[model samples]
Target: MTVERTLHHFPLDPASRQVRLALGEKRVAFHEVAERYWERRPELTRLNPSGMTPVLVETDGGKTLVVCESRAILEHLEEVTPEPELMGRDLAERAETRRLLQWFDRKFDYEVNGLLLHEKMEKRLLGLGAPDPANMRAGREALRAHLGYVEKLLTERDWLNGRRLSLADFAAAANFSVIDYFGDVPWTDFPAARTWYTKIKSRPCFRPLLTDRWPGLAPVAHYDDLDF
Candidate 1:
């Protein structure tokens, strides 16, 4: 039985991007449905009561399964399609991968995205006024700290979790890519992190994210440049 898959997501959403990267890396065929989740469309809410993006709906002939949010969807993908696993193989590796996943989804999102994305992308989409300079400054500072941590990790290992590419890489990349779109990442100051990013950016799965553009939002000139 062939399983048909459809993903509901927002173009610039980090969570959505994570799912997309996982699907692409796993070589899974799925359809994309872009959603403006902030609007809280009734249809979207029906799929996921929380009204978040990155919902995955899978149908195998008659039966259907709906997975909501990035974490659940990512775990579901790994469980259903074990080949080319994104989670690490061993227990320690898997634990580290999950820890980083939480770090990005919680700590990173709170310190960085909550302030930066809210001021820049959310405000523009919702027709709010100009970005708060104080918030932007704080976000940038926090981002540099995060990048320094990434550089440290890269110095020790090949990938974020350890030796192999894992979901941790996708999580960090998804968040960084969005910030990079706005030309905010201080890549020049973080050579190791830049090198790591360059390697992932060259991957086939990362190609689609480079091309994502929302109305009224323009990306930095080098956002899509693999060589940049």
Candidate 2:
């Protein structure tokens, strides 16, 4: 029996990107549905009252499952497909991965993506007014600080959580890809972080995101450059 999977996501949304990468890493085939979630589409609101995106709808032999929220979707995928374990190998490693995943999903989102992406991507898509220079400035500063911390962490381990590649790496990479789409990342200044991201970008699972395009807006020139 072939299971059908559909993912409702926004092009520039980091959370949506995260779930996409997770599904790809798990080698799961899914149909993509571009969503204007901010428009409060009836079908979306019906599925998730929060009206948020990255919703995964899966239909197996006789069962249908709806998974809302990026983290939940990732966990569900991991539970269903345990090979190439992304969370980690042991309890402690899993805990660290979860902690870093939350940090990227929450703290990083609040500090950087919340401010930078809103001004750069969200407003443009939503037809909101102009981008606020002030917020962009603040977000850039936060990004620098965050990048510095990431570099520091990479000095000690191969991946964000530890020696193994995990969800933490994907979470951070998803957010970074969104910011990078606008050429917001200071890749030259953060060599270590750049090296880390270069590796992530080279992965087969990351290819789909590199090809993502918005109607009028295009990704930065180096956004998909593996050598970059």
Candidate 3:
């Protein structure tokens, strides 16, 4: 018998959620093991020496196939499942999509996620001191600049870089939700991004994400409403 494929991840993590959303999008059923990412879980560290959430464990021939890192997991899924086509199938299209995915992951991580989420969610989740006004302000400023860059991308084409929606959109939205925690995005400033985000957020896979909450930080009221 082929042993099952399972994913161990923290529920609130965007990178982890990106994989979850991919699983949902592809309609791939896998066991979900909620891993404690903030605290150092021994099992998690044992399974993944890097101590990262979003580890994919595939059991085959009585051996555990361990894969760590978000990008690697994504590619592995594309190779093994090959359905619903998160990464484009063709050689050129796949390479281009990977480029855009990296752009979304790297650019968004540096410019938006660390800038905004480091201030708002990280402090709260890590049980550190209260929010830093300076950090919060910095995040807002950085997010606005990044949003403008997103606008530039939107102006050039419909999705991030191609005719169809790719992992780039999911990657971008995953980061945006972190910033949106602080109500940082001025939706009015970028209509194209706003419109595209609204549509993506309205998807069934995205709905559960809207309901996610930290102890003191529930989502903004409009997050779950889907029309906001």
Candidate 4:
């Protein structure tokens, strides 16, 4: 049976970007519906009561499956399309992958994104006035700390989780990509993390994300540059 898949997501959303990277890496074809989740469109809310972006709707003939949120959508994709095996093959690898996923989704998000993204991107999108200077400073400091951790991890391993590329890499990349869009990432201060990002940025799965653009939010000149 052929499954018709549709992804309703916000282009600049980190969570949405994770799912997009996963789908692209897994080679799954799907239609996209760019949503303004803050407005809480009735159709979006009907699909997900929380009215979040990154909702996946898959229809196989008459049967339809609605997977809400990035985590759920990613897990669902892994189950249905297991060839690429993004989560991991072994227990240790899987555990590490899940751990890093949580780290990025929660810790990194709260510390870095909550300040930087909320001020730079969210405030602009919602017309909530200018970015807060104090918050931006704090966010930059936190980002450097996180990047230092990433640099340490890369020093001991090929990928974020282990030797092989996993969801952990995608998770971190997704978050950093959004931050890089605003030119806030201190790439020069972390050479290892920058090199790692360059590797992921050159991947075929990352192409779409490189082209992502929103009104009044222009990416840095090096945002899409693989060598930068």
User: Rank by TM-score, descending?
Assistant: 1, 4, 2, 3
In candidate 3, which residue pairs clash? none
- By lDDT, rank the candidates, best first: 1, 4, 2, 3
The ten-residue window of minimal lDDT in model 4 covers 186-195
Q: Could you tell me every candidate's TM-score relative to the true structure?
A: 0.99, 0.97, 0.90, 0.99
Better of 2 and 3 by TM-score: 2
Give the alpha carbon lDDT tens digit for every residue of 12-88 in model 3: 67788778777777777789887767787998998878898889888988687888877888888888878878776
Summarize candidate 4's per-residue lDDT along 1-228 as a digit string, tens digits: 989999999999999999999999999999999999999999999999999988999999999999999889888888999979999889999999999999999999999999999999999889999999999999999999999999999999999998999999999999999999999898898888988999999999999999999989999999888887
lDDT of 4: 0.94
Local distance difference test values of all predictions, in order: 0.95, 0.92, 0.77, 0.94
Backbone clashes in model 2, listed as residue pairs: none
- Which residue runs does candidate 4 get wrong by more than 4 Å? none
Better of 1 and 3 by TM-score: 1
Evaluated at residue 106, the lDDT of candidate 4 is 97
The better candidate by lDDT, 2 or 4, is 4
Model 3 lDDT-worst window of ten: 218-227
TM-score of 3: 0.90
Top candidate (lDDT): 1
How does residue 152 of candidate 2 score in lDDT? 94
